[model samples]
Target: MHGKLTPGLDFLSDGGEMGALMRAHDWSTSPLGLPERWPQSLRTVVSLMLTSKFPMFIAWGPELAFLYNDGYRPIFGAKHPHALGLPFRQVWSEIWADIEPLVKKALAGEATYHEDLHLVMERNGYPEDTWYTFSYSPVRDETGGIAGMFCACTETTQEVRSRAALKEEQDRLRELFKQAPSFMAMLSGRDHVFELVNDAYLQLVGHRRDIIGKPVREALPEVEGQGFFELLDRVYATGEPFTGSSVRVGLQRKPGSPVEERVVDLVYQPVTDREGNVRGIFAEGYDVTERVQAEKSLRESEARFRNLADHAPVMVWVTEPDAICTYLSRSWYEFTGQTPETGLGFGWLGAVHPDDRAWSAEVFRDANAKREPFRLEYRLRRADGTYRWAIDAAAPRFGSDGSFLGFVGSVLDIGDRKEVEERLRESEAAFRTVTNATPALVWVSSNDGNIVYLNERWYEFTGQRMDEAVGSGWTAAIHPDDLGRILPYWQRCRETGEIYEGEARYRRHDGEYCWHAFRAVPQTGSDGTIERWFGICVDINERKRWEEHQRLLINELNHRVKNTLAIVQAMAAQSLRQVGDGSRPELQAFQDRLFALARAHDVLTRENWEGAELREIIHEVVEPYLRQSTRHFEIEGPRLRLIPRTALAIAMAIHELATNAAKYGALSVPSGCVVIAWTLVPDATPRLVLRWQEQNGPPVAPPTRRGFGTRLIERSLAQDLGGEVRLTYDLAGVVCVMDVPLSDEGGMLEHQSSH
Candidate 1:
């Protein structure tokens, strides 16, 4: 069958597609001529190349004609048929420069070989990158001389690209591992050799960055017997993953340093191939030393707290933020005879007295919901099945992270305290009976200003029932005009916890408004804290009327007194004018003194004869001097209230001082100024010190004899004031000091004469 396919070319027979084409090809135009005329060595080589299943090609004669087998046809791509009879260089013209030298060497009998050599070929319509593992070897002639070259090749483009892509992916993964936040490492083989590690791994291992390429046991010698090595071995042998949390491991972080304790959370995953064989391990984890230590400390603290609570005198309890009881101290169990199973959650409420259980639960739940502290007084069932009052107090608890944890509370037995309180209540009833029998309208108010008690007299006077007059209801009995002002004043005193004294008109049961004197004193506890306001309301309408009548008479008296002084002034002027004698100046001086006294009387009357401000008196006396030029005097003083007698005396003294100053002192000159300043000295005996100093005045000298102005200031003023007065005459000016004692309550320090 082979001989029939091509009679003169056995090498071209049975070669599949390429063989069939070669059999019909017209090789007469080729430099090598027809297949029948070819040399035996060339024919034998072509036969060998065509018979082989591997890819093979041959170049023949000086033209180096290209010939290839069926296995090599795909390598030529679209150029397969046409490339058969072309020159070898022309068939691969795109890579001729790269292959020409190799072709020459093979032809010279050197026989070169290249594996996976790079080449650019135009076998297709366009140029492309191609790779191949091919060899070039000389084909010998019948005489054993080199005739042409032979080549066996395979296109390796896919394989080369696959390898490059795999390397790129590996590099990217390595970079990701290096920059990972947690520690990561790769161990290669069962020995657990550190093949790769990231910076995080270095930090976890302390000062051991040069750990790669070393076995785990050798690199970290201190971790040898710490069970990590055994864990790794187990994982690799069983081809399983191992996980650890808060695992203890000792480490030598610094050179020649003591072994330090450490803890970690880690995973060891076995690395394997397609055969399910364990090849290496991939490790990833976190250093959890600080977290482990904190947990240990927390456990110890809880233990200590439990120990203390067990021995405590009072019952202690703990609850979750949801108000569910979680813990109860030994005292609670011993006192209540309750076991843990019957005491947790809302079960503890069963031990409370039936009357208080509902309200106690409500108070506790409400406080828990709002995360607030609370206090409660309730009866608790004792172990002997008897009830006893208890004071329970608790405050909200929180975690270090500010999370609401729960509540811690304590409960103390207060049965004795309750009995004492009962006795006090009976004593209060007896006291109330006595108050009711009295003629006064007695009442009691809470520290918060709520009326808590009212005797029979109060209800009888106000014509109101207990409910109608208690708390704020009695405010209706107050005259509307006084209600508004008294309510705020009463509330202010309550806030200050001070005594309250106020007058308000009270509407009587018969519908008439009457003045009432209200007085309330704070009733304090043993701790000195106000517990209640004990008060009384007294009827003062008759006294008020009498005071009003007296005030009217005083005003009438003031009017008559002013009229009589005016008549006296008129008479004095008329007598002096009629006399027409040298005594006219003296009479005028006397009239001026009377005028000063009358002005003082007018100020005292305006004040209701109680007192007058020293500031008002000073301003009154200086009114005459300020008529022309107000700049002649500088008067400065604090507001001081003086008694009526003292005010009159001080006013007269100031009048005399100013008169003398105008005639012979600082006020005597236009440019001269007087500093009239007074200050109150708060000493053991508070004193009012008034200073009158003259400046820039004409030279002054002691008087030849004592005159009325001097006499009035030194004798009358001092005697009426019951204080001292100093008058000094210096060449520069005249200075006067008026020193008098003053009461801290703004009254007279001593007896003040009306004169």
Candidate 2:
């Protein structure tokens, strides 16, 4: 198949490099056999194609064996070497359908030509988009019958792509221009020939589509004397931009229609080349005739007496320069039961109540003469024959030239507002009367922190004059040391709108300083803004002295009680000693119980005997247990402050429970623990639920006998608290629950309770 240059391939000689390749090519497996077996016509065509520089190929015989010249070698790409003698369809299978018909026509003796034909070809191992201009001609065999096709082609991909890109960019720009909102046009050369016009330009020019490609002068003949032509010429000649605002122009926009005058804001900008030479003028503008005409209509109608309102919310009226009524709104007619006949001119004056007519007329006349705005309240007769209050207000209207036209006025129904005003005055008067009669000093302060009013009691207390007692001046009577704390506290309360309360000393008229309780509450408006502060100062000097005396008496009583308990403890000790050593342990227990009572009383005294926190009382009785090496007690509950009597009873009960626990219960073992928790049960009469649960303790049974300590815990404690007490002896541990009465007003009480 691959021998030295085959001497039999004489026809392939002197035909370029493809001829040499053909001579050395294998012919044993080829359907065409070899170049020597090829028909004379095919040989001649191949030879001619091989010597030519143009791309050329030949398909010969029934196999239509493919062959190509050296000039077309690059088109074969990776298909060379084995492609020379392959079947044409196999060689170009990717584009076979497209070229098969042409191949058939050529073989049937018909020649064909295609210019810039598009194709997708698989060459060089990948498919590529390409274009070609080619011709297919039939070639005759030795019998003078068409047997094969020959083709000559040239790739035109670059040229086609360049043309396509240019068209795409042009289309995009044209679309942008057509969609522009402003009228735009391009005129070329000195004559200003129309080159392009967008849709907006056509709309502005009455939709004349035939203007493109025509000279501006011929296209818009109606704009001959409108100065547009002159402006366009000047811009084109001098290469300068021309801008005009509200320029007047006349146009015969439609055929057989009269000329319509229009106003426009226009700009003529010169279009230039890269050389900076002007080539054309671009025109852009907007039509503003509607705005101009609207302004003109407004001035004309309002120059003298205008219908300023017809459907206003309130009654409206207009007057001429001479104070003659000209017009009234529909509201006025409906309200006053008058129409054009009775409401126009001075007839409207009849609607005013008889009692107010003279003064109302004089007020209107004086204001109209002075060209002033005035508001006045007067009684006006309604359609139902009722005279209702109304607020009449009017302002002078001037024309564009500053000439006074008339007064445009409105009347609003103030009947409701007048009633409210009367009620407010009565309320204010009542407030003053009550304050004056009150036994304490009262003051009113504006939201700005300035005291605006003070009752007579304040002057009586401080002996200051009315002017001195009101406003910031009243601070003069305040104890000098108290002002520093009061001012900042008052300021903070003013800022946060919180109620303010404090005890401050004020100098009485007798030159004595007395403690006074000062309380101020904010008066808030509907919108949640504080409008003012109302305050009172009550004398508390007597209460203060009484409380001090009570405290001193309680201290003295406590000291005496402690002394008596010590005396009794000593007496019992001495009696037990006399009775012998048998009662010694009982005497020790008695002393411990006394100490527990003393601790509870100590807690109460710290709070001035007012109350004691339940937590504080529990800790006091458990102080001995808390010092142990291990934690044998766990107590938790909400914070609660108990009255003195309740504190004493609860402390005694807890102390007894702890003593029993240490001797025979949870505290007897290292693993044993006591968990005590309490909670409030809210009910008609709220109750405190206290639970003492012992865990991991020695087994328990009912006690053989009840001791005095147990009796005290079960009976006396429950009676003192006005509740129930239960103690259980389960096999596992000891449990105690005490339900005690709490104060009824639990909500107002915080964590502290009056139990």
Candidate 3:
């Protein structure tokens, strides 16, 4: 064996094995120790392999003493040392359990060769199932009987487990891919033919179920020119995954119509083999039409918001949670003369007025910490180094995760408005001071009659506080008797926007009513609308009392003057009667005429010399002389008004005429009738024409006496009223006519008649 072996073999054997092998190359030194460098177990196994045709192993009792060269070290691993001399049951208990029956059968002299035997054994910590064409032949001793069994085996664990795992993984992938909601498919080769298609893919492409294994273009002839086939080819050739979001694809049916397209998100993954060569393409996609449209609309909405913020009159800004300015509109730069970058961080604080810096910072800090909206008014330093009032407001912004991201805010310049407010305050203060200093009560009321403002004088006078005086309650202090009249006037002023002046009594602080001359003037705006009313009330109680006393005194003087006139008329009548001829009848007539004049004066005085009713004057002066049956009189006229002087003159004239008629005309006969009719003349000169007509009496004639009766009628009517009187006595009757102006004896009566 050594001579036949090459140098490579000699090196494997070693020097001691070569020497021993040369001495007893055939008999003394057997093939067992010829390869002395090898272990006894391997040398014995190799020597047996020359005779054994089958792969085999030799074991002593329970220990496997020798295994064939076909068995690699991998089969034993760390169990090699223990298996060389240990009992087979102890060394490989798990394997012994399966081989024990076979070993026993072989030992009973029944030669056995098990073909394609399946055995499960433990190698190291792993349980391995192996397939083997095994032969266990009895190694007979010199008697040619069974001594020990030889075993031959092969492992098939890798092929069996690999086939099983591959089948399981393929089944799992198929089930998962089919159940997916999204469209999925495998395209084979550069032609992009569909090798596999899930249910979702078939549904998406509107394909029949049986066409799944067919090429996509062949199955759906409608999709020939579509871009999707080309896209798949590119992905396959490149051996790279392709992704598309919302890639539109038009259907082939109607090329000119509105394109029927779907927004889809697609991904193509290249399937590769063990050699890293691209084989097929796997595509997964979803319909994202609604989501794509919604995203577009959201972007448009954000654009609109940006436009509004940019163009708004106020300065708009956004800041981060750390108070760093993130955004500022153009208005901010225009107003503050500071760009957004200049105002980043706490740089915006520099623009704040020195007086308002501390307050602004405090408010900013508090709002940021608490994540609340902030609103405050402060002054900001302008480009001109002047400070202007500004209203700053900010609302905190938050992220979807409830983090305080930042804030959105606005700044409005109110400098002009602030100046106007200050001026208004100064004016109001001055008005209040002036009104309070005055002795008269002053108030300002709304157009609706609500008291909006009042001076101290009003409160002092009413014994009420400012609260009580405001609104309609201010009227509570007004005397009840005057409220009716004053309230109407006040309302009129409000409606007409006029000045109101009236005298009324108002209650004082001491619960006494005092006469006050109240005046209110409505204040109007440029549009001619009444906004409010400013009023003043002065105390007039003392003056009113004095005027009342003066009126009484005047009335007494008028009475005395009337009495004196009556006496003068009486004295003149007596004196005339004495100086006249001894015609007793004429003397008596003269006395009667004087008496009539005296009676008229008395009637006028009774009316306070104001005026007298025409009918009343006629009845009073005539009833004393004429019996009801002997004289009949009628008075007819519209209700007419006469001035005091005109009424007196008319009354006296009527008395004189009635006296003469009673003495010498109509009243002397039972058939007599007298009619007194007066009509108002409508003209610039308003006059009253009165006629005293008598009839059915003895022959009538004018009085020859030229006595006081005739003179009195003529003078009273003509001198006092700028008119004339005529008396005529005829055979048929006597008639007297009087015409007078409506005024004091002149055309001034026209103006007087207006009253």
Candidate 4:
């Protein structure tokens, strides 16, 4: 039936009619398996599916028959009917330029495929770039011949742009790894073989090329026996990461040669799957050989220093720059009787002697502030409650940056030496006082003969100030005429340490010369070293003049005594000659005896009357009588110095005996000999006894007369010298024995005479 329509309805009626015709065609082709009817819902479903959120499209062969999809409407917005049933190249020429090749390949029975394709297409008259992954497949007829191309595809512009950005990020990561300084590697698989290694890793292993896909041990063979492979095995087995500080690794360039070992700080990181199972490991490390060695050397040096401090004899201590002690050696405890803990810090200051504390503190403060070495003497209190002198020396310690770190010091005991020095000073002062108080001029000179010290008497004698006479100044006061001799003598005294005495003229205060007796003796130390000279001088002018006068008096006395004795001898001889008038031989013998006494006295006086040798005295008295040249005499006694009176008396007594012998007794013939010997008897009161014997002469008889020879022999020595004299006329010979008292010979005689 024909239907009438309004103008607005006609427009909707035309679309409805077209829809009905499509449904009618589908219903009629139902047996041919065509769609039964184009339902209103079916049209709406197709439209919604094409315009879904994702970009979607449908194409047949090289043509776009319908473009209900929202993705395609933009490409043919204003050109509708012209775009329908047109080749895709004719509707969107720019997009079809690339899409046409993919469509032809699909139509030629190629399998469907998609790729990232960039298309510049006009969208509402604006050119736009669109990326897509459009796929095409063959639309076959019932007979299986290629009929047309069917396509179902989506635009992939956002995904393509995102993938490009990800690639850029990966490339940047690769660049960073290439330029890295440290060795870096990626390890995978159960064996922990390297999957990838950077250039730095290759260089570190000294490998010229890549070491990818090789086991760690095979690639870095140098690390086989060094336990690195074992470490890697452990990490793989445990699936744990490890970080090491200063690990040692040995690497060798040649087999059997010394390895190039290095110290490194390293980290091993475990790469895990999403399930947290470790699948690989990553290694990162740096060579730290130099730093490790330096630190080790520093530790060794510090240990050596500690050992020295522990064993030192002196008290070694360390303190902060603030003067607070930090460490004290073992010696500190031994010397101070305090433990290390008690001696540290300012505790040590408490042990200082009160008298020295203030000064020591001041010195320490100044040295600390100035950062200077400190040396000072102080007294430290000992365990015995006495303060001992100590020398404390310290030097500042500085850090590497030149900042003052602290101080190291030592303390040494010097109390004994200090006491000795003090005693020496006191002794020197006492010596000075004694020398000044003496009446004689005294001075002490240096080893070089320069006057170093002098008594007050020296200044008084020379009239020079102490400063003026010190050193060589004393030479100025020496008399010019005596200087030549005195200076040489002074030099000899200094060089040889000999006692020196010399008479020299010295210049007095008024510039007049005076005769002074100078005497000097070198003062020596215990080592026989001459330290200085002690000298004394006295004025000897008066004593010298008196000695000269006494010489003349002595000469005159000797001459007078000799002349008187000679006259006495002459008178005695005359008397003897007179008594020889033919009848009294005994009287003549008495006169001869008197002459012998005078002659013996003359011999004793010539020997200074002190004493005479016994043998000499006997020879002189007996020579006239014996006349025998070989008369043997033996005299044995302690060496004796006898008084003058005893010697003279003994001489006279011997002379009388010898005279008797020559005249009528033992010595009348040449065959006779006399032997005289003397000895001293040692006792509280010693006595000298002499024996005289004669032999080979005529038989002797007692004389009847009291002759002068017998009287002189017995009386003079016994009475004058306080001794006994005996005369014997024995048958064998004439024997004379005399005993003289050693101690009061003359004194006893004088006492006896006074009584």
Candidate 5:
């Protein structure tokens, strides 16, 4: 069978893959018989497929033997090499039910055409969805009778899927346009005619059915004069987008309805073609009427506040949230003499005193950072080149949403009041100095007897810490023996607001018990209520001992009186021999010495000779001179004690100095003044230094000769008291200095160290 075919009968010589496969195939056992016996119509179709670039297939004879061109090989998938010369039904049996009618119509001599036809094919071994645009035409025999079917087809599977995907996308876009929350509309043409609108857009325009195909101005005529129509026209003509916020619009829903005003935020975006020609516009917007109205109301309220602040009395100011000044009241400008250009922002800091600017700025910035209120006092430079104290108080401002806005503040000048407060502090300091120097322990309490203040002497004497001794804590420092009764009496005084005088034993820091006379007086306020209690605890231990000694002295008084009388008789005999008249200088001098001795005895008698306060002895000696002159005198020192022998010597020395001062030194002149001060130097051996300085007196020459007072002050005082005394008489005035050792803890000097 292979050797029988001649070249002229060969049907598979021209086509590529399909023709080659057909030639090499065994056709003797096929239904079409041999290639040479095939009909002329089939041969003609085969000749067309072989030379054509398009894909084509033919079926011929009774069994309709299948044939296709090389361009059709891919359409068969994996069945190409084996499908040659097979019957059409056998070759495509999987889709035979779908294609048999189309093939039969062509064989009956009728033509058919299908575009993008759907088919399920298994040419590659498994079923697949496929499509094609093809035509089935009848092939005639030489006698004009239908013989076979011919098909010219192109697979359109990709185009079918693309159209389906495009349809799905269009459906989604239509849904989005209809169901959108904001107002949206589509316009077409240069006339800006409305083509499509969603539900929101319909409601916004107050139109239900009459808007499509109508121009924007004709559909919503009330918006014609509101510039919205003009805006759409501009976007269409220029192909540029326009956006606006809080745009005013008026709408009338029906022919007879009144127009209503509305505010909207909107945009008109042009839709253009690939060549950049403008088509129409896409409109999108939202209603913003409520927000716009609210902002208007807030602006009105702010105006009212500004007016009030402008006329306020104090210096009022406002600042940004970052503490930059934004506004200042008229009073502030007048006070600082600054213009807006110089006072705005941080420039106002220049009005603050140079020393206080850094501190004031720090405090202000810190409060601003925390968004808190604050108060501060600082000096501000006023217009007159003077600095005045100002109290600046400010509070942070916040919005309704609780966000920090800024600060509103005021300043008040307090220069006069501040001066008064400073003076009060100075007065209190002076009072404290006097109380601290006193030997007696002093305390002050509230009307209810809660201790509020204690002098330095009180702390030193009791060895109590300040923090531990205030209020009720002072009770712990009282001697246990005396507190039992003293507490009851103290309560009585506090209740009745009466003067209290009592005796008690107080414990010293050294753990020694001493008798003290406690006295307290209530000071009343203007309302006749007790303001405070001032109390002093004076040491009276010596007085107590003196009383005890006087009892024993009663028996010895007679004997001592006889000895004193005999010594006085001898002294009188010597005075009578030295001067005949009682007015003589020697007699008067002797009497003055005797009187000085007596005054010393008087001080010792008051102290029971245990000790005498050195200050008291000095006061007694100078009392006469102090009474005769109006000179100012200052006496300052801690309280000190003197033994009987030392007290007598110091008393004599003071009397002689006073006598000389009255005659020729500070006391003799109206302008003269005296300052007597003493201090105790604590050491392994303590020493007390007493200085009496006089000023503003007549010039003195060291004294032409040593007078009796000078001799006593320089020689007798130093020898008798075992101390050193120096008397200087120069141009200014007289100055006397005494240095003596103190033993027994400020009691008396066992020896003197001269300097």
Candidate 6:
């Protein structure tokens, strides 16, 4: 029905570009015929539509021939040129069901309007989610009968999606504010209007529910005269943040309650808009009332006590129940030249001769734990850093109600008496002869705890003369780090008059440090006063190393157990996702892999998990299947050892291959067989090559897609053993090849084990 067409009619001539396309278009392939035969109303409507700039489309006749203006052409996307004259239903078949009702309504002379309507369309090659706001109206004929529909549309996808995203972000912000731990609120404008308030802020203000739209002055009127109002005004005018630490404020926490005093650490930060103009304030703070009150009470108590102790002749001190020094009298500070701040909380220990501090702290802590009165003598550091002997006595104090409070102590200087004892110890010639004859190193100290003598063995082992090893000079032979700990314990034992036993690393005559156990016993006079101390040193280095090695082995075992459990967890999680509940083929396959791993572990465990022989791993995995069928498998490989990780990976791979053969390849047939072999390639870096080839099975072809077995073989071997694997489905058989690095832990153990 091809013919030359003339277009001189009023409607045809008036129609713009689309009208020209419809008139010149071929109608043979369409349900609608030539334009000359189209209804008068349809031609008139198309003529008016093509000249309009607004997006508009028309569907004409019972067949609903589609027509659109140039402004609406982009709505067709890639469907352009051909969509102009096509039936409306076919042109937009993907969304035809969604829009057909609206088209029918318009044809019935009932107009419809939609705002932000959701639609999924495939105007292009692929479907897209789209939103539109449009109106549909009926087009009339000369007989005043509705023939078709007209649409004026506007796309609203971007606007609608942007609004939804903005709302979601606002909700997220509100949730964050509501759950914040600190009291937080947003105040807007110069009046500090409460724009938003979080739960913590509401609780802070005594749970007042109606405070959100009110100014801070109206919501919290009690804070007006507390200087907080002034602070807010200053911040709003200058747009600078204000921070207050432990600031006192008066507040009415409830509707009809008396004003209460509270302390708070607060900050008022300014929030700015896109233009960099500050618009509102963000208030954040935490209440510190209890901490502030406790500190105030402690200061008052310390002031009253210092007045009485400052002029006391003896040094005085006080400690908390935990043995942390809380206060020291003026006499004690003057004697040690340490400030109250430095002397508090175990800090005063720094003034003790470094060697004696450790032992003194231990004795003091022990006495406090038993809550008993005790007396001890130790060297203390004078203001000039000279060590002086001092005797200290302390008694635990309790309240009138018998509740344990803390300890109160006093100290007396005893350096003068210690000098007299040193001269008496020097006159004892018989004591030196007996100690010098012993093989052990020996030393003696005076009543004042100063070293007075070193035996011949002591001088020989330390590579020092008697003079150099006497007094505090012997500390030079003690390792620097060990001296800090050992000196304190030795001094404590001397002061407490207890048997001293301690360990230290002492520098030997050869310049190497070795551990030694030192023991000392005090000889006291009839008056119960210590006259001298006798000590001996013995080597104990070998025992220390043996203990350290045992610890390392136990830690390594724990790490391996944790790693194995994690691997099992990952395998179970993946298997459960694929198979779900009940027994299925996927579940059975996972069980086989799990059992293969267990058998590999059993072989390694038998060897203490250091490693296992490679042949053992293969035999364990394949033995079960080989015993069940008449088919046989040829196994041959060098006797190489495999570390725990490499052994497990190989075991799993072998199990997968054997199972596949049983299901669809070699082992499925009576005459089928499998050959497994491996060889070692030696060099600076050795490698192991393993091959699995099936034979005498049904003709094989490569699978169309990968299965679970293929993925496992490829991923596990590469990750666990750092190996490469290639699986090929040959026409006559299925073959697999693998290459793995050979580490010292997985090197050859013996010759081939063939079966």
Candidate with top lDDT is 2
Return the clash pairs for model 4, or none: none
lDDT of 5 at 260: 79
- lDDT by residue for model 5 (353-452), tens: 9999999999999999999999999998888889999999999988755889999999999999899999999999998999998999999999888899
lDDT per residue (tens digit) for residues 1-755 in model 4: 12654222222232332223322332342322233232333333334434354444434433334333444444355764345445555666767766778877766888577887788867567887778776776655445666455555666778988888999999999988877878799999878788888776776666664468888878777687777877777787888888999898887644456779778889888888899888989999876777677668868977887789989988888888788998888877777888866789977887789888888989988999999998999999887677899999999988644789889999999999999999999999998889889878888786677888888988888899988999999888877878887777767767777787878777888887777788788878899998777778898767766755554554455567657656765666676667775335655555455555555555555554435555555556555654455433334443444555665677677776666667666667667777777777766887788887888888988888887667776777777667797778899888888888778644211211100
lDDT of 2: 0.86
Model 6 per-residue lDDT tens digits across residues 470-521: 7888999999998888778777777899888777888878998888888889
Off by over 4 Å in 5: 1-6, 142-144, 188-190, 207-209, 233-240, 254-256, 270-279, 290-755
**Backbone-clash count (model 3):** 5
Q: Between 2 and 6, whose lDDT is larger?
A: 2
**CA-RMSD of model 2:** 21.7
Candidate that beats the other on lDDT, 4 or 5, i.e. the better one: 5
For model 4 the TM-score comes to: 0.40
For all candidates, what are the clash counts?
0, 0, 5, 0, 0, 3
* Candidate 1: C-alpha lDDT: 0.85
> If the candidates were sorted by their TM-score against the true structure, best first, what order would they fall in?
2, 1, 3, 4, 5, 6
Each model's Cα RMSD: 19.7, 21.7, 31.4, 38.1, 32.9, 32.5
Q: lDDT per residue, candidate 1, 635-655, as tens digits?
A: 898777788877877888888
Q: Model 3: residues >4 Å from true position, as ranges? A: 1-298, 301-313, 318-325, 344-346, 364-375, 393-410, 488-498, 558-755
lDDT over C-alpha atoms for residue 380 of model 4: 90
- Candidate 3 accuracy as lDDT: 0.71
List lDDT for all candidates, in order.
0.85, 0.86, 0.71, 0.70, 0.82, 0.82
Candidate 4 RMSD to the real structure: 38.1
Per-residue lDDT of 581-684 in model 2, one digit per residue for the tens? 94677898888888899888888777788777888899999889889966478889988877777778889999999888988999888889999899989888
Candidate 2, backbone clash total: 0
